[model samples]
Target: MRTYRYKVQTSSYGLFLGITAEAIQLNAPPTSRNQVSDRVWLDTGRVHHAYSGRKLALNGQEVTWLHLGLREYTESIELGAPGSYVLIIIHALEVVDADYAEAALAPALAKWTEAEFGLAPRSGRINRDSTTGELTFSWDERPQ
Candidate 1:
């Protein structure tokens, strides 16, 4: 198993997203619309901040963010028989309670992972560290 880890830190908090796979592949096609299209779910915590619209585009292998007031969002494209991907988004806030944010986002993240990539958690765990103010999520590939 290979583990891929990525971390992004802001002044207020940090975000971590990872994925483990038997093999990882990247496909960079010439056409703009080479990516697999899927709907992403967002949990804005507050009703007012809910994601109103989604516009997904592929710049090489990266998926752009949906309009949800997020400072930054990203994803990786995996190429294979059961191709899949992972996404990470961070909000720019002056002061955020990491614990609360993690608790609120975990289930939403899980649901998004399953829906977007068609993969379920095979091992490991997802969590957010209050002290470090980092939200962490991970998933493994399904068995053949």
Candidate 2:
């Protein structure tokens, strides 16, 4: 098992984390629209979650469609606004899915943004279209 870690810093002040993996088959369907917020609904691998330190472990071969649902707080760093953020670190082992893991994990982060904030915002430096008045929110920001 290779030491693998993925880190993400989000400006969402109060966040709830939930995870899903392809390896574990769900015996029953999710009880609610946002099971991620309901920590009790989450079980390891099946409906994986971390209430305290936010860490998950699973066999590499069993996972393919791993996704995370990050429940967002009311406050958000608007398109061009500045704010503080929280950093989330995910640790995993590389045994059989090293190649696929990289591609699959990248999109999960973006999905988190959509799940937390609506489609109007995206991850990256802030950019706006002057004529259209469109806003491109920043996914990562450096505090000075």
Candidate 3:
């Protein structure tokens, strides 16, 4: 269970997440359409400003892989019986209460239990650990 922490700040319109080359796995299965972005879900809040959201593709960013938006996020993934792979954890934004930092969308997360490069959202909220930051959606590996 790896944890990728993303920081969200309020933009002039809505909110934006800063993604870098290290934010996602650079080396994953190649796609015919590398430009296509895969979707991941944000359980904390609903997003009201997707139109303003664009890939903040920064210069000199090591984007060997890019993630497109999907309808959701997944919990576990089966990358070919434990073949070496990186889970492309993307940091995107959706609309939610500003006070809460985490939402456990376990149902959505479970979709990836054995998926090969699948995108799904956490189905529900599991825990809210605000020890570090108070405005973040995060997850760890499923307990053994």
| Candidate topping lDDT | 2
Compared with the true structure, the alpha-carbon lDDT of candidate 1 equals 0.31
Better of 1 and 3 by lDDT: 1
Local error of candidate 1 at 77, Å? 12
lDDT by residue (tens digit), candidate 2, 1-144: 012233333452112223322211233434432233322122233222333443446444222223232323212412222232222223332223222233334334445444433444443433345677342333453243
For each predicted model, how many residue pairs clash, with residues at least 3 apart or on different chains?
0, 2, 28
Off by over 4 Å in 3: 1-51, 54-82, 98-100, 103-144
Location of the lowest summed lDDT over 10 successive residues in candidate 1? 65-74
How far residue 42's Cα lies from its native spot in candidate 1, in Å, is 17
User: TM-score, each model?
Assistant: 0.25, 0.24, 0.26
Error of 3 at 141 (Å): 13
Candidate 3 structure lDDT: 0.28
What value does the lDDT take at residue 94 in candidate 1?
18
The lDDT of each candidate is: 0.31, 0.32, 0.28
When 1 and 2 are scored with TM-score, the better candidate is: 1
Over 64-93, each residue of candidate 1 has an lDDT whose tens digit, in order, gives: 221211111223223222343322232221
